[model samples]
Target chain A: MDYFIELFFSGLTRGSIYALIALGYTMVYGIIGLINFAHGEIYMIGAFTALIVSTVLTIYGFPLLAVIVLTALAAVIWAASYGYTIERLAYRPLRSAPRLSPLISAIGMSIFLQNYVLLAQTSDFQPFPALIPEFDFMEPYAHIVGSSDLAILVVSAIVMILLTFMIKFTRTGKAMRATAQDRKMAMLVGINVDNVISITFITGSALAAIGGLLIASHIGQINFYIGFIAGIKAFTAAVLGGIGSIPGAVLGSFILGLTEAFATGYVSSDYEDVFAFSLLVLILIFKPAGLLGKATVEKV
Target chain B: MIFSKRMLSILAAFALAAGIASNASAAETIKIGVAGAHSGDLASYGIPTMKAALLVAQDLNEQGGINGVKVEVLAEDDVCKPEVATNTATKLVSENVNVVIGHICSGATKAALPIYRDANIIVMSPSATNPDLTQSGDYPNFYRTIASDDAQARTLVDFATDTLKVGKIAVIHDKGDYGKGLAEFVKSFLEKDGKAEVVLFEGVTPGAVDYSAVVQKIRRSGADAVIYGGYHPEASKIVSQMRKKRMKTMFLAPDGVKDDTFINVTGKNAEGVYASGPADVSKNPLTKKFRDKFMATEGAEPGAFFDNGVTAALALTNAIAKAGTDSAAIAKVLHTETADTPFGAVKFDETGEPIGIGFVVYQVKDGKFVTVQ
Candidate 1:
């Protein structure tokens, strides 16, 4: 029980991060039908941004609280810009081309961004500051859930809740849904599909930036390659939850995270990845459209 | 048709003249090449080692050329890869450098050994510590300043029994050749010593986002301490995870986790963490002098391996000064003669492994590694 509960929290913490990143993948795929492979690199860039901003802000004598807030703002701002730019320059140009073209371009963009950051900063792992304050009261129960882990769970919950509310109640959310359902129909109905698609990217990237900040702080290190692994897991989460479904992405992430945690704890950590992938195959085989995904009819 | 007889003759004459002039210039300077991962995963280790070699070469040249021959340092980035190491060794052979200072990774050193052996180039690695490199007996020119991984394992095994005084322990490895081999070596040695029982010996997949399962197993086994044979990144995370679960089980870090990065990443969780490594020579006057100068000039610590690099460079330079450009003469001196290095007067056995290399145990205190034994 306590052991299983601990694993649950750990899984939940990891799942929330995966959900945050998966939302980016699902959203881009929802609005434009492109995988947005470079979305992972954007997350890495966000961590790097936070690293630099916090270091500089601390050197300039900003209080810890101020530095933390500014770092988050700086990371989201920069990552959002990168997301907007990538969609505009890479995906937008290939929107009307064969679907394969944008996919290849997304991969190319991913590589380009990885190397660019490698050259600009460094290839070595840079330690990220533990932005969350350590509460001595939590020390007694630190083994169950550390302060940073708690912060990750709380922040991600709030972000997810806000995202759910916005999508359900806002005009832009309706436009986004309309665009994802049928781009031609959405455009014909004066939805300004382009703006809606860009906004989707912005929101997705912002969420990913938060994920990057949270995970970097949680892991205590960030590097150019960290994003690649996190991105793959998040992409798997999106696929597992059903591509292009927001709630589905979060749900998939939690399932994957819990499975990984439980498998690692009960079986062997060596087989953890094996278990996760086998579960993915089993689920996909039976559900095909993913756990919460709707069946799509292709007009032949 | 483009090259008539007269044009061909003139071009050949110019080429012959240029070749002779370049040969004369090459004779005036002895070039030493440093090859390693100047970039990529192990760049943190390789880049600094190469930099220390270059600094030594510069300081040596400034003090007057070795044997009246000026020394020049050339560097090649092997990216800590064996294939790339072989490629870099071939490039260094083409450059006709007098000796080489790297292939700092064990895999890279092993892969490039044949090339250097065939080319008759001496490779003095500052940090490659795999026992197989020196034990293979196939390469006579290979040498390193640090003790082999087997030696490190032996030291840690002793520490586990004598220092920690733990009866039951669990040994874990990251499954890499270096980590797995060292962990197995330690497990075997511990068993042979008849002091403690290894409750669990298992391999964990590195780079997993979580390792709570491994921790749970270790906890259930009720091991007194966990000896991890791996690099710091994974070790730091593992230790942090254990501490997060509030397990105070002792964690022993090998040379791979002795660096500052481990402490920084683990932070407060690293308190009471024990680490093992070859004895520190940083306190020696000569090494301290170099470090002080390096710190003031370079704006960063040269790292633990840096002094070893300087020592390796000094040994090579001593051999070079004793024996001119003849690589065989240099190899003979390196094997038989004692060289005065910052690590103290160092001597190599027939296998080129340092004879008197030692290891120590350290504990992390207030975010710094303090020598415990």
Candidate 2:
């Protein structure tokens, strides 16, 4: 029972990270109807940006909170620029071309970004200083749980709550929803669809930047390619949550994370991925839309 | 008709002159083909290896030349893929390189060996550690300066069973040639001792962010220790996950996870993890000097495989110095010469591999790697 609880919390913490990243994927897909593959590269860029900023600040003897805030700002700026540039250079030109063209271009852009970072950074795993101070919170339950696990859970929950409030109450959030539902209708109704779309990207990228910062803080070092796997898992989370549904992405992330944790804890570690992907396949086959996602009929 | 004939003669004359110039340029420089993972996850090792090779060429030229002829090092990015390695080998052969130093991964090196052997070009690896590369009876030109996976595995198993007194052990591998091979060796050695029971044996994909499932299983398996034969990235993730789950089993790994990146990635969770690798960093004065130089120049300590790159450069330079410019003669001298390197004295056995390099065990304590007896 203790083992199970530990696994459950571990999974939830991991899932929270995926959920945060998935929010970025689902939001852009919701507004633009394009699966921004380069978003993963954007996340990687964010992490690197945060890493560089934090390292520089630490060298200058700045306090941890100051370093973290500066790093977050840098990550947001870098990721926003990257998202904007990718959209302009790769997606905009192919907006009128076949759907496959833009998707292929996004993949090409991802590869280009990966190689660009590799060439610039020399393909080494540089250490990212921990921005969060280590505090033992679950000391009483040390045998069953750990401080890092509790920290990941608490931080993730706070971030998610704040995000939920932003999307539900903010003005830009309503415009985003309006744009997602009908781009043509939104434009006809005097909505600045392009601006709404860019804002949606900025919002999603900011969240991803936060995720990148947390991940860098959790994992002490990072490299150019760190985002690829996490990005895939987050995409899986988005799909699991009903891609385009914000709350669904969060739910899906938790499920994926917890499942992986439990599987690795009780079953074989090698089969953790097999189990996760299999669940995704099973969910797709049975629900077709995802656990929290709505089913949409395809146009004949 | 006369004007048309004159125009044809002029075009043919120009084509002939261009062909001659191409051939003349090609004949002037001896190209040494180098292959490594220049653009993928392992590019950290590959890029530095290439840089070391280039430095060797620059050093050689400064001392006159290789047999009165300037040496050229042409690099190809294999991306650590076997198919790419084969393709790169074919391309290098087509380019008529006299020798090569590449295909960093054991599996990739194995794939390219047949092509290089068939083309009669010597292929040396700075980091390939799979024992089967030379033992497979197919490679005559393949050589590696570092100790093999088996050697590192033996060192790790000895530390776990004899020093740590780990009664129950769980083994995890990354499903790659290096990881799987090392894990298998460690498992076999542990099983032979009968002091340890193998509770769980599993493989994980590389670059995974979460490894809670495997960590949880190990926790439940009643294992006192876990050995992961993989690179630092995944190892760090696993360690972090284990810390999250509150599993207290001691972690162990081979040289692949012995980098400072492991501690950086895992933070405080990296403490107490034992690692076995060639003690090149602590065993040699030249390595210490090079480490100082690298830190002074690069503003940080070189990564785990930096010394391996330097040793490879030293080996090639020594072979070239002895052979006096002929690559075929250099290959002969490489077989005969036994010289001290940054990693200590290295001598190739009959199959063109280093003979007696031993592995050392170390443990992470307070974010630093400290040698363990």
Alpha-carbon shift of residue A24 in model 1 (angstroms): 1.6
Candidate 1: tens digits of C-alpha lDDT, residues B1-373: 6669889999999978876776687798988999988988788888777878877777888888897778999999999899889999998887777899988899999999899999888889988988889888888889888888798888888988997799999999998988898899989998899999998887787665556667767887889999999998889878977887789899986889998888887888889988887677767887887787688778988864888888888889888899887888998888788887778888788898876566888899998999997
Model 2: C-alpha RMSD to truth?
10.4
Best by TM-score: 1
- Position B300, candidate 2: lDDT: 76
TM score of chain A per candidate: 0.97, 0.94
Any residue pairs clashing in model 1, and if so which?
Answer: none
Residue ranges of candidate 2 with Cα displaced over 4 Å: A142-148, A155-170, A298-300, B1-148, B241-248, B263-271, B281-356, B365-370
Q: State the TM-score for model 1.
A: 0.73
Per-prediction count of colliding residue pairs? Answer: 0, 5
Tell me each candidate's i-RMS in Å. Answer: 2.2, 2.8
| Runs in model 1 lying further than 4 Å from the true structure | A56-68, A135-140, B1-146, B280-342, B345-353
lDDT (Cα, 0-100) at B217 in candidate 2: 69
